[model samples]
Target: MAKNKNGSGFSRRKFLKGVGVGTGALSAGLLSPAETLSHAGGALAFGTPQGPGAVPITLHINGQAHRLSVEPRVTLLDALRMDLEITGAKRVCDRGTCGACSMLLDGKVIYGCSMLAIDAQGHEITTVEGLSHNGRPHPLMTAFVAHDGQQCGFCTPGFIVASKAFLDRTPHPTREQVNHGLGGNLCRCGTYHGIREAVLDVGNPTGKAKTGGQAHGAL
Candidate 1:
């Protein structure tokens, strides 16, 4: 028989008993938060507690550091759209599934809706709005427009951002490769074909060169 080995986890019997005790105490108003913390023992770490209120946090976004006071539960998408007024990332699914709220964190693609605003501090966040140089569009952006890669435009920003990450990883990709690379982002308008084409156009210079480098802007 195996014993509870540090953070490995609790045995089924121990877990059920603990849950039963805690739930009953919580329901009967007998378990105080301080008491609960006190019972947790020193080594069974729960990490540093945050808050049930707003906290000051700095988010480095698009070469700028935006300081704001937001609740610990506030998502990065909410911070960008609500607090910071940088609303390039759409709030469609609000979950990580649809990828409408995708943004580039530290030059890598991530779903903004799933990440806490507080956790994004000290990291470079690039939104769709940042993908322009002196108001000039990135080549991938141009190619997207030229290929009619967007229709509803809700998923376009996420697709473009994800495409930028994809191109960075696979700068010279085939049509099938682009299709596979950008599988994370989805479009309700069924514009996958055009989106793939745009990525290919940006990758292939044999066709008219759209703009600049793969790393240009957010692309």
Candidate 2:
């Protein structure tokens, strides 16, 4: 037992040597701060590390379930169009500002480009391809065609999906409301007039009147 100058049992040199030995043990992987802390806190097991490769994701699209292996960084738009072959959601501005990649996530409108594919799993995703059923077109689709709402058609699918979401929520919206609701989608053909008319047409459709066995369009 070494004695210090002040009569302490342990000398400063002994304390320094113990510190050096502890540091050497720590550097050599014999002692880990994390393990020591975890033991002190009564934690027994360390979590398993994530495996390599893409993660398994389950996407509910258009009422159908699709299992895919996608990277953590894959965008929802890419997953829908490229991997899943559901090209209804267009990729115009890869960024979220364009809204051309708009789709229904759990019945709510969201920009697919902005959302991660992994995050969209387990949510009901509706694309333009899933809008029509049993060969019958959706009301908005019919209205779009009837009113010539689409011109270039590059942005048609996105507009139709976005419009469907809006009209489903508000069947009879005013012009201001329609404009505000559809503010997310952009059309390069500048066919806003027809789009507005189409939305209104669906909201208020004139029925034929029967008089004396003759059919006449209702006023």
Candidate 3:
């Protein structure tokens, strides 16, 4: 046989043979496409984004510590409602535009839907459910009920939570101040009058001592 110009004497037949062997090795070692995809999505494994996997963290809420494993992408609202079973914060807009998912973070009101659970670590989260104690409603809660601030009640939780933060800062807010402070929360029922009255009642001297009395009776 005549020698090829290249020192290795490579030929089409030899190249084809090498490809066949390499393909055979790959076929023997690799999984099917469906099987590979299934494995990739199976669990907390390699090649997965660390941010999407469940991570252990503590949430300080309502004067208590909650230990849980949650994905970093899980919103504070979802973590509270789904994982912790604290559904007081309603998922209304779920987009921060509506304050239905509002909660107190370190005493500052924030939209729970817009915040990541991982970012809330080490901060005190106060939800609507946390506002009550010993079977007694918070002053704001009492005022809401007394003033009939809620109709459908879907937005009541967020309103009440936001009111707490608002009242904490401006304890005796005027009608205008109350309007501006709680502007974030929206009520479809057009109960602005009642909501404003509810919050104002908490600070009014005439209504302070009578807290929960009229509200409970009315309820």
Sequence-dependent TM-score of model 2: 0.70
Report the poorest 10 consecutive residues by lDDT, candidate 1. Answer: 22-31
Preferred candidate (TM-score higher): 1 or 3:
1
lDDT of each: 0.76, 0.72, 0.76
RMSD of each: 15.8, 22.9, 21.2
List candidate 1 segments past 4 Å from native. Answer: 1-48, 208-219
Top TM-score model: 1
TM-score for candidate 1, please give it.
0.72
State the lDDT of candidate 2 residue by residue for 1-219, as single tens digits. 245667767765447656764222211123344543443422223364322445555677988866665666779998776566577788999887777898998788899999988777657999988899997999888889988998988888888888889878876666666788899989888998888778767765652121122323222
| Per-prediction TM-score | 0.72, 0.70, 0.71
Report lDDT (Cα) of residue 117, candidate 3.
86
On residues 1-219, what C-alpha lDDT tens digit does candidate 3 reach at each position?
123578677755446546764222222113345543443323333364454656555677888866665678889998787666677898988899889999999999999999988778768999988899987989888778888999999999999999999888887666667778999999988999899888877856465423442322110
Q: Which candidate, 2 or 3, has the higher lDDT?
A: 3
The alpha-carbon root-mean-square deviation between model 3 and the true structure, to one decimal in Å, is: 21.2
Candidate 2: residue 137 Cα off by (Å): 1.3
Quote the positional error of residue 88 for candidate 3 in Å: 0.4
